[model samples]
Target: MPEHSRQALSDYAVAHTTKPDSIFDDIARDAQTTPSAGMMSGRTVGYFLNTLVAITGAQRVLEIGTFVGYSALMMATALPEDGELITLDVSEEFTSIARKHWARHPDGHKIKLILGPATETLDTLEPQFDVVFIDADKDNYPEYYEKSLNLLSPKGIIVVDNVFQGGRVLQQDVPDDQRSASTRAVQRLNEIVQNDERVNNVMITERDGLLLIRRRDAHLA
Candidate 1:
């Protein structure tokens, strides 16, 4: 792709994909008031996540980050009537906005928010979730991935957001010890997932990047 067309390509792709309904617009509008508004997962990832739930027929889902609930609601829409999603976040302030919007939709009942540090919250969760999404603090990516892997059901998929770390990992490789903490964790995650004999993976380059992984020989314990 030409340099000029790079951004245009992304716009074109998002335009062609399933457009989010007006409720998402409302959520986005509310989130815009915050400094970290940019962290809200946009329609590209949200739409893809929705589709993943639909196709996988996932009955239960786990999300490590719930930024204003954009992605959580997207996945919830694709779930069956009896399905459920459990989302974790540390901020009541940010998630207060999420709660307002979740209540606006009928699928809101499908979502349950756990307000606490994700690492601690992960320890309390039982395994066998059909899908686990990690999108929280970059410095803890490796730890999150390890715990998420164990929480995932056999044949379940783990979808990691921001794995590219805004193209930082694309630069010339550096010794792991020399990289910044956040960068090192993100890079190490990509490396570990790619080489792990226990799972198969693919990295999709769209809106940052998304890493999708699943066990090669799945067995839920």
Candidate 2:
């Protein structure tokens, strides 16, 4: 199938599930016009992030990727008045756009943008995130996943995006040129999650794919 067709299907699915908020729509517009636009996650993924934050009653959240900040806005809007979300992104330009959209909301103050490599940002954080969203560099996904789990509080959930790589994970004989470095890296992370004993996990085929992991508290071999 063509790439546009796949995106259409994904958009259709998301439309039926959740209404697009104004902040999300504005971010979509910014992404369309921006040079590095493709980094943004799909609306389906944003909806899932919103739902997960609300359902988990998460007050403190950590996001590994801000992109144009669609997902950050969605999750931040779900938080209570006292809730806060700290987001980390490496791109100064993209995050500048994110800050603009966030400023429009009354709860915008709840959103904090950390400009730096996510690994470095995660390292400095104190453990106790109610929810964690990982959607940054694919090559560092496993590292992000491990660190996110450690940062999560008891009963916290960690959501990892882009695990399916547009259904490429199941395909064999794909040309080396067509497969992305990130795709290969995500495939390895998928295996790690499947075998990990520290979390109860499930892979949902959303816009791309989402790995939902709830940290395990007990010691395991």
Candidate 3:
């Protein structure tokens, strides 16, 4: 095919692929807004999360960050009638909007939203989960991963979003500040996962990035 036509075809392919209804899109319809627009996870990442939920037949799911509940809604939609999802977020403002859309879905009742800082909220949970999704504060990536490991059952999956930190992980000259701290923390978590013996891992470059970790016995690895 010609160069321009080939480029056009590729663009079309990308656009025509399955796209999840994002919270941002919902906001556009409702004329609602948030500081970040809750545009964290992309369509590809959302679909991946949904597929994982369906594959594992996850009965219980824990989400660290419930930004507008986009990911939670996507996951809840895939859960069995009796399955449940516990989503935590500090932002009551955003969660309120998320609740609005979530309420519209028949399966929305499966989602239980907890408001408060995620770390504090997670501390109160029992050790029972089929899957846990970490997408909260980047600086706490390691903490979230460690906590999720304890919370997850054997064979359960722990999916971490934005592990790439917008490609800042590969950059040089990070200043000594919170931004630098978050970047450094994410780097440390990546190293931890790379050497972790308890989980099989794959880091995919979808949306920002996604780290899919499956907890299994050493023999299974």
lDDT of 2 by residue, 79-164 (tens): 99999899999989888888998888777899999999888889999889989999998989989998998898888899998888
lDDT of 1 by residue, 179-216 (tens): 77877789889999988898999999888899999999
What is the C-alpha local distance difference test score of candidate 2?
Answer: 0.86
Best by TM-score: 1
Sort by TM-score, top down from the best: 1, 2, 3
How many clashes in each candidate?
0, 0, 0
Q: Let me know the TM-score candidate 3 reaches against the reference structure.
A: 0.85
Task: Assess the local accuracy of residue 87 in candidate 2 as a C-alpha lDDT between 0 and 100.
Answer: 96
Return the lDDT, model 1, position 36: 93
TM-score of 2: 0.89
Clashing pairs in 2: none
Worst window of 10 by summed lDDT in candidate 2: 212-221
The candidate scoring highest on lDDT is: 1
Local distance difference test, each candidate: 0.91, 0.86, 0.80
Q: Considering summed lDDT, which 10 consecutive residues are worst modelled in model 3?
A: 23-32
lDDT, model 3: 0.80
